[model samples]
Target: MATQTANALRFLSMDTVQAANSGHPGAPMGMADIADVLWREFLRHNPKNPKFANRDRF
Candidate 1:
């Protein structure tokens, strides 16, 4: 799941950069794993209600 999540992030980042022809894709590609871990483990929120009044902010 971690690998999949990281790869998904990498794909999105790379795709955006490729499409825009600007910015560095390598940054997101390199940090995907770290980001995936952080979001999955410690900084999560309800996708459907990310701005819920009672939820703690990341």
Candidate 2:
């Protein structure tokens, strides 16, 4: 699951940058695994009410 998310993020970054003909996509591509893990496991959110005053969004 994590590997797939990482690969997907990398592919999206590369594709978007390539299409735009600008920006450095390589770093994001390389860091996707770490980013995915953090976001998927450690990052907190309240999707039902994202703007809730007490939501631990950070």
Best by lDDT: 1
In the range 30-55, model 2's lDDT, one tens digit per residue, is 89998998887887766887787755
lDDT of 1 by residue, 1-58 (tens): 9999999999999999989999998889999999988888887588898887766564
Candidate 2 ranges with C-alpha deviation above 4 Å = 54-58
* Residue 14 error, candidate 2, Å: 0.7
Give the RMSD in angstroms, all C-alphas superposed, for model 1.
Answer: 1.9
lDDT (Cα) of model 2: 0.86
lDDT (Cα, 0-100) at 30 in candidate 1: 97
What TM-score, over all chains together, does every model reach?
0.82, 0.77
Q: Give lDDT per model, in order.
A: 0.88, 0.86
In candidate 1, stretches whose alpha carbon ends up further than 4 angstroms from where it belongs are: 54-58
